[model samples]
Target: MSLGGETAKATIAKFAMAAVGFFGSILFARELGPKAFGGYYLLFSVTKLADRPLMGWATASKKQFADNETKRRELVGAQFLFNAVWILIATAIGLLLADRFRSYSGIAMAPFLFVVLLVSESNYEAFDRVLTASGRVGLSTWTDALRSYLTLPLQVFFVFVLTGYAADGMVYGLVGATVFTFPVIFYYIGTRPAVPSVDTFFSLAQYARYSIPTDFFATLYNRLDVILLGMLLLPAAAANYEIAAQLTAPATFVATLAGSGLMPRVSRLRAEGKTVGQEVTNTIAFSSIFAVPIFFGALAIPRALVVTVYGPEYTLGVSLLAGIADTVYFRRRQRH
Candidate 1:
């Protein structure tokens, strides 16, 4: 498919995922209320922070897979090994710090749930990068949409139908959805594990050396605020900040779409000795068109938007939405 077609499909999938996530967030916030939802968000943020290290390898694998098709199976095997080791180490660290995490997050099962979520999320990230790297950008995005759509009903079932699970139910629902989708992702990639080559490890390491620190700081920059609020203040405070952040999150969609679709295309073109100057230029122009309006629109109606969508209880951080929207707009520009 042409780049335009691939991006259009990806955009549709992302829109669906965003719509589902937006409504799901509102439902969880209203049903769980501020405190429980905040606790869940706090744990969610922690998993994001913990998963940063894997992102380096995931990003590198995407680039490597796109650049060297002959080594695809080797890259997959090496990444699988790396992820397995990382999960074990991360789980051990979480266990060691279990008590501290519980006290800080104010959730008794935070550490245990963290381990489950960390593993599931890491698996999803790995698979997502692999699919995108292989140039199935639309399929990659559809998998994400499937996960989002599946997660909401499962969360509702666990939280309400099962009774008493609350925030923990949300975690279970997320993990279950991810696990359920693995077979589809696996079938698309269709590579059985080969013996990992030593050369492939070094090749991945070379790319990851630069990507790792970039992923780490990016994760920290994006998530540190919520982490701090959850730790320093109450979960409700963190929830307020999260509400503002979520409301402004869609501003970055254009940039994300450009990045996701362009990277593999650019890498492949470079591998074929083709210049990508025009592609990059076109993406920048396209992103700017949508970004400016979204930024201003959010600034204009922060309070009413929040109240109507998430209800009045989430109005505490209405003032922060404009600033957060601006931050998201600039961040997207910087990334693009």
Candidate 2:
């Protein structure tokens, strides 16, 4: 399959993930009382933010990974190592600060931490990275499909049927789902593992370091709201906000897919000593044009969506999310 074609398939897979996320958001709101939901959302958002330490390494990593097997192994292995470290540190800090945290769910913190640190799920990006770099487009798409579509239904089942406690059940489902990605990533790496020769380790670290700050800031912008909400509002209030955000997930997948696909291609052009002007243009214009509608439409009728999906109890934060959607759609993402 062609690069764009493969990327399109990956985008479809991401939409499936987005569907899971979209539905998962509603399921959690229903299963947990708003308060518990709030706590869970806040925590999940923070844990997600911690993942930013890897920065956009997935994108840059793909660049190096596209070049050589040894380089790929070292880059991926080091990134995996770094992701583990950051996830652990963040989870520990979350635990240590629990009592002080207004958004603490009564649920056990360790399980969520385990999910955050899961090797299989956490390294999922590596699969697409390897596939994109290797030009194995269609296979790359399948892996994402496996992760998203396959895992989503199971998650819904857990949330709606098995446990019915959104926070716990959703986490259980998500953790279970992540197991599917590990095999795909390993397989993508093929026989020649990205083993870190000492040189490669340094290469990995340097690359990771360069990408960390931009991702950190970008991630913080995404999750910082949840953290602040945990501090400022009650959990249910936070959850209500989360509900509005949930509606945003599916559509945002388009931007994500665009950005992800654009990166590897841009890297290839650079490799061929080509200017990446069009690549950057396509990524930006498309991301902006794509993200604008979903974001604004949600803002236009946030309360209706929230109330319809999660029940009337979720009405309070609709306006806030609506405002946020409007602000961010036009303001924050126009540049990149």
Which one is best on TM-score? 1
Evaluated at residue 89, the lDDT of candidate 2 is: 75
lDDT of 1 by residue, 94-202 (tens): 9999998887777899999999999999888886888887678889889889999999999999998999999999999999999999778878987776767888898
Candidate 1 to truth, TM = 0.96
**What CA root-mean-square deviation does each model show from the true structure?**
1.5, 3.3
Per lDDT, the best of the predicted structures is: 1
**Which regions of candidate 1 are displaced past 4 Å?**
none
- TM-score of every candidate relative to the true structure: 0.96, 0.83
RMSD after Cα superposition, model 2 = 3.3
lDDT by residue for model 2 (1-336), tens: 244565567666666667666766666677667876776666566656656655456655676776665466567666666666766776677667755543254455534443454444446654456556666655666666676666667767876777655566666666666676767667766744444577876665677677767777877877777777777756676787777776665556545655666666766778779888866665565565446777868757777777787888888767777766775676536656
